[model samples]
Target: MAQTAGVKPMAIAGRVALERERCLGMTDAERAWRKQWLKDQVLAANEPVHVEEYWKERINPIRRFYRKPLDVLFDKLTPMLGASRAADYRVITGKLGLIAVGVMAIHYYFKYHGNDWTKKGGWRVTRSKPMVLPGQPGFPYKSERSKDSDYADRGYSKSSLFDGK
Candidate 1:
């Protein structure tokens, strides 16, 4: 029912988050070991002889390429991600949910309020000035005295709609 549906999403999200943490927490040593193992497999396949013969022939060169780097990488990484407690997984998953909620809330808030901050032309008002009609004179009360000058030039008169009563 409803409970199961809700639990499903949480479980899926938690698993994904756990997997991400696991990968992120992998030590350089572990990664290097994995990479070298893969490389060894590839080189072995490319050998012209049986597996034993290939290992015997190419072992030295392959070891030279993969072993040293793998050891160095493993040594560096082991200290960082070598061990994780069961509680650590739970904490990481919780953090993942919190992050997801925080991000969604921010996105929602922006989407909801972003339009209110912008005008028809996408212009944002940072000041408390009143909007002026296009082709009209400036603040009517303040510019009243100068009306006969610019107003007359623009063919506007005291009877114009923009002329403040």
Candidate 2:
């Protein structure tokens, strides 16, 4: 990439904020103030900057987005739930929501796809072991008789799906 004369390389985030403020009707003075603020911030923080720390914390795009909506939602619910209760409720619900989604995804994977997955620790049997579906690599059950079956004459198909109960 070549830099043209008079062309400045602002970060993509700064460009987005610029467009957002323009769309939301920012005055020219406000825009000038923002530009000055950015220049001042760059001048103040340019020296002794830790590249590793900046990349670790400030590189996330989602955090930039989630902050606004979460703040808005917290403000809306605070009147009803109180400040402390609202914050606690947000944290609890966020964790529980992530957990529910994870459980549902794992259940779906195991039920539909019978295969082992390689992980950081070791190999894991993500699906049913010795898969019960027909044409699977191994038999689902050992050579023992099924608990639901006692009739020697009846084939395996004779037992109802819920006969164990």
| Candidate maximizing lDDT | 2
Best by TM-score: 2
Give the poorly placed runs of model 2, Cα more than 4 Å off.
Answer: 1-59, 66-70, 116-165
In Å, residue 125's CA in model 2 sits off its true spot by 5.9
Residues forming the 10-long window of minimal summed lDDT in candidate 2: 114-123
- Model 2, position 53, has a per-residue lDDT of 70
Write model 1 residue lDDT over 105-155, tens digit each, in one string.
878765555433123333232434466776677744254346455432322
lDDT of each: 0.53, 0.63
Tell me which residue pairs clash in candidate 1: 29-74
Work out how many backbone clashes candidate 2 has: 0
